[model samples]
Structure formats: C-alpha cells, structure tokens
Target chain A: GEEVAQTPKHLVRGEGQKAKLYCAPIKGHSYVFWYQQVLKNEFKFLISFQNENVFDETGMPKERFSAKCLPNSPCSLEIQATKLEDSAVYFCASSQSTYGYTFGSGTRLTVV
Target chain B: LAKTTQPISMDSYEGQEVNITCSHNNIATNDYITWYQQFPSQGPRFIIQGYKTKVTNEVASLFIPADRKSSTLSLPRVSLSDTAVYYCLVGASTGGFKTIFGAGTRLFVKA
Candidate 1:
C-alpha cells in the first residue's frame, strides 16, 4: 500500500486492562517506527523495527510497553497494564531512505 | 542525532507569506533537514526536505545555507487552512535510524 495503515482509530481501556495497537507500514519500507504524542505535543519515540527484528527500543518503557513486527502481519504495540498517564495518540511511520517519512493516522488510546 | 530549535509559536494573517526557521548547530554531514506539518488531530505529514541550497515543491520550499546549520520553510501566501504545527527534524532516516522530532513551531494563521 502507498500509505501506512493503522487500525483501531480509537480505543478506551480500563486502568488495568491491556491495550494493543496495530500498524501496517507501506510496502517495501523496511523500517517501522512508533511514537506517542501527549497533549497535542511532545512526540516521544517508542520503538522501531527493521523487518521482523527489533531495531531501537531505548525510548520504550521497560515495564509495561512492548512491541513486535512479525512477517506477513501488521506491527503491534501492546500495553500490559494501562495507566491513566498512558492516554495519548500513538502514531506509526514508515521510512525507506533519507528522504522522509509517511505517517499513518494514529490510534487514540484513552485509559480511564 | 542532531537536535533542532525552532520558535515556540508564530502568528500570521491570511494571504501572508510565512517563513519558519530552524537552527541545528550540531548538524552532521550526513544529516538532512526535513519539515513536517501536523494539524490538530492528524499525524505529521512530510512537507519538504533538503540537504543544501534550495528545494522547492508544490507545498513548500526548503532553503539551506552552505553551513547547513540552519534551514527555513517558506510557505507562500498561507491561508487559514494552512495554520498548523510545523516541525523541524534533523537526522538520517535511513539504515534503521529513527527520525526524532523536536518541539515544533505552532503557526497560527488568522483572517
């Protein structure tokens, strides 16, 4: 596909419930990146994948945040136990070269 | 990754030309300057990118000096619909390197 595809436009989860988001990068793009945007600003990098392997996850919270990009499937970001502060818009982007990135409409996660 | 600095906010009238400048004093040789425009509830969209000199597209123009330490995004005759947050990113988006976004410039175009 020409544009990156993200599933579940909006999700509402309980404090302790698990929340999962999906992203399908553009075809032929080898890198997939996930970002968390809070309060309409402050974009925090969460994780990235080079194919099915984890590339850089330094920004990801070690305790409750985990992500995976498997073959023939859309990439997924999972939250073990959702917290109130976890409410934000989660964006996924795909890049092929040094040119630029193509971002998908993010998944809005609200934990009550 | 090279870090970029931009104005926190800017205001302009409709049908006015707006130029948003960004400074990346520590930019490296391989780093490229890219700009993204984001609306209130949408993801950031790639606007323009340049390595040096000037690059122009239908959307906007990107100008870079010889030093490559600073770049400007030129939006000609912007209207109210063009009002959005503009982000200046400095990095190599290739080789699995992530594109890090800095604090963007909030451009408010009013009638």
Candidate 2:
C-alpha cells in the first residue's frame, strides 16, 4: 500500500509567529493537496499542486498562507502571523491520478 | 462540484448493515461520487467511488440510481472498528483539480 508521509505530527506556535508543515507524496504520485480540519469538522480545501506547479489555491489565505511542492522534495505549507483561528489539523494528500487520494495522518497546529 | 447533503449522525448495531445516503441534486455529468472514512485523530481514507449503478469493493459498496441525484454507501457486517466519520464528495470524474468537502455523517457502531 502507498502512504503519504507528513512530518511533525504536532506543532505549537505563538500567535503572530510562523509554522511550517511538510508532506511527502506516495512514491510515483504527482499531485499533492492540502486541507484543513478545524475542531474535527469538515475538511476545507486549502490548495492543490500538480507536479511542482500550483493548480489552484482558491481556498488558501494569501495574506498568511503559502504552499510549494518541489521535485524530489517534500511539499510544504508555511503560515506566517498565525492567528488563534489558525489552530487546526492540516492534512496533506496525494493521488496517482485524479480518482483517488491518499492522506497523511496530519500535522496538528495549536496557536497559543 | 455539487453540494451534498447527508445525515449528521447514525447509530447501528454491530454485525448489521449500515447504509449512509448523500444527496447531490445538482450533480454534473462529469461528477463522480466518492466516499471516505476517517477515524479519530487520523486523516480520511478512501472507501469507495461510483459514477452510476453500483460499485462494490472489499470494504464497502456504493449504489447510485439512474438519476444520479443521490448515492448510498453500504457497509455490511459492520464492526465497532467501522465507526467513524463518512464523507461523500462530488467532483469531476476526470482531471478534477479542486475538491470540496461537506460536513459528512458520523456513524457510531455499538455492540
């Protein structure tokens, strides 16, 4: 079975500080996506990347959030000036094609 | 992408069949219905997907009627381990770059 790997299962940051989460797609997969789950609620799409290029980032907060996926390197989501509302579990997922997506356990960020 | 509606919660007994329904009245022709299951403190895992008619996998079965306005995910002989949050997503079948998720249904299986 293929698995998406994520680093730093837990992250704690002070408000107005910065936090970065990392994700590695399953071997041979090209598409990576980011989603946020707040209070164990719905999974909110943050961004999507096709290969090393960003396909869509409509859900991303441009002022404080950005993501990048470089070839042969794990993808990363960086958030600057974190707010209390930014506390949530950020998940990274990858798919060989567009049909199915495998998700990482996620990085839980707590902004204090 | 189409809006999906599902029950907020469901309760089932162990060893019984559990069926969760999702309604997507505005589904487009290129859209497909996909389901995912998530346990506590873990990310969602793909369960089953279907375009129309029926699709059955080792873990669950998906049934879609002719109208495609609604779909059902059927889990047979469910155990306690099957209890989790189930999400039904409707998105373009091919080259769908954007995916939207709904509130989903929380299933509780009891002994």
**Per-candidate interface DockQ score:** 0.68, 0.66
Least lDDT summed over 10 consecutive residues: which range in candidate 2 chain B?
B92-101
Worst 10 residues of 2 chain A by lDDT: A93-102
lDDT of 1 by residue, A1-112 (tens): 6999998999999999999999999999999999999974889889889999999998899799999999999999999999999999999999887778899999999999
lDDT of 2 by residue, A1-112 (tens): 4789998999999999999999999988878889999974777899998889998899999999999999879999999999999999999998876567899999999999
Lowest summed lDDT over 10 consecutive residues: which window, candidate 1 chain A? Answer: A39-48
lDDT of 2 by residue, B13-102 (tens): 999999999999999998889999999889999998899999998999999999999999999999999999999999964442777788
- For all candidates in order, the CA lDDT equals 0.92, 0.91
Say which docking band candidate 2 falls in: medium
Q: Estimated TM-score per prediction?
A: 0.96, 0.97
Task: Note the residue pairs that clash in candidate 1.
Answer: none
Candidate with best DockQ:
1
Query: DockQ score for model 2, please?
Result: 0.66
Most accurate candidate by TM-score: 2
